[model samples]
Target: MNNIATTLFLGKGYRVKKQVRKGNELRVYIEYEGKQRCPRCGSENLVKNGKDTKWRKKLHMSFGFFRVYLLFKRQRYKCKDCGKAFSQVIPILRKKERFTSFFKQAVIFWLIFFPFDLLSLLLGVSRRTLLKIAEEFISRVMIEELKDKERLVIGMDAHRFHRKDFALLLVELLSSLPFGLIQDKKKAFMDFLLSLPPRVREKIDEVVMDMTVRYRRAVEEILPHAKVVCDPFHLISYMNHQLMEEKRVIEVVKKRKIPGRVLRLGKEK
Candidate 1:
């Protein structure tokens, strides 16, 4: 059972000592698989001091519909080489954390498509916790992924989600993945582009955006080598507006000529 648990869920370097099931909740007692080594000195010459009797419960990925928790009693060891005492680190959970890495990742994945309130109820976690997980995950992803791009085709656009507020979104055109969002202001948009490294800015060859004069100016100033292309939607909207204005003028002229033509025909008859 320990071997199977280690292979399936608990991962290597952990052995399941015991398991208790109460309805849909599962409590698994786990410990390190090998001899306890001193973290400070990395030596096996250590004496058992005592057990950390604190209540440590780690929330893990669910098994089907059942909630799983890993309960562990951390072992304290006194190192002879370093003359210090330290507790064994749990590989599955970070220090001072209640959830496993895998569980946090799962929550982030669900949050991408589901509302926070709905996900919170489904996962039995508080809404605040779900939001924190998402924020940290997105921050890490953006820092790691966006900075290292060698070449890019970016797109910028503004959207109004509310009546009086607007947001500017920046996306990688090739992948259609959003990288940044800020208030729909010229300064905000310029600052966001300027925040990137010079190498990254140089690698941007093309930017697609609407015919906003501010957007065009900012891109030209920051990315001197990049070409800016106007999106088709803006062009079509402009053409439609001009055509409507011409049609109104033509209708007024025809209405004015019709009265004169009727009067002349009446006089001649």
Candidate 2:
């Protein structure tokens, strides 16, 4: 048995008197300790009241479900100022809640580590709920690392989006995090590049990109200090297949009974 799990349960309003595990099932016998003050006048003076009836509920664990045997030790407090006897509720656990604190922790961990559908299947929660938790975790921990940096080298590239062969991406090289997607029009890409700080813009040493003339023009227009270099692989591959492309287009136009010279010039153009 994990003592930390037992300690977490005790810290979360459950007094675990005994804990035993049989096979994969863990059984915990706990007593719910009521509040310390009098319920009527909120006085600290209290006397022992008789034990309430025992209650049984199921709690989820990592391995399987365990039956929690709860002995409600209700205390009747005699108010010194008002002279009234009343009961108080425990502060840690909410009223009528069946799942323990450890169980909640397990669910949160699962949501962070696994995908939404898998986490929903494991914890018996809806996928939407898991996605909400995942988004919360991302909001709490994941923030823009490129912002407020002394030097930021941003590289832009196009990635395949569905059937579209190219959707541009901006990468912050210092943090190795994706900054923004640059697609659609030239104006959008130019605007994104111009938004960086002047000092950070001056610190940019080099811009590595494929042999796209528009991308080169945009980088030169925005980042004046940066030297542009054509990424060799894209240039070489495009060059090697350029002739093959012209031949294939010419053959297609000839098969359609169009003039081959005009079609070849169009393919070359």
- Sliding window of 10 residues with minimal summed lDDT for model 1: 260-269
Pairs with steric clashes in candidate 1: none
The lDDT for every candidate, in the order shown, is 0.75, 0.58
Per-residue lDDT tens digits for candidate 1, residues 1-269, read: 66757544666678777788989998887777557777767889988889977758888866445788888788787898898898877666788778988799899788678776677778887765765575456545663575677778988888653456666767888777677666688997788778776777878899999889988999999888999998788878876677666555655866542333434345412
Residues 82-134, candidate 2: write the lDDT tens digits.
Answer: 77766556543444555544555566676447754565566665544443333
**What's the C-alpha lDDT at position 16 in model 2?**
68
Task: Name the runs in model 1 displaced over 4 angstroms.
Answer: 3-8, 34-46, 62-66, 150-269
Q: For all candidates, what are the clash counts? A: 0, 0
Give TM-scores for every candidate, taking all chains together and pairing residue i with residue i.
0.54, 0.38
Q: How far in Å is the alpha carbon of 267 misplaced in model 2?
A: 26
Candidate 2 residue pairs that clash: none
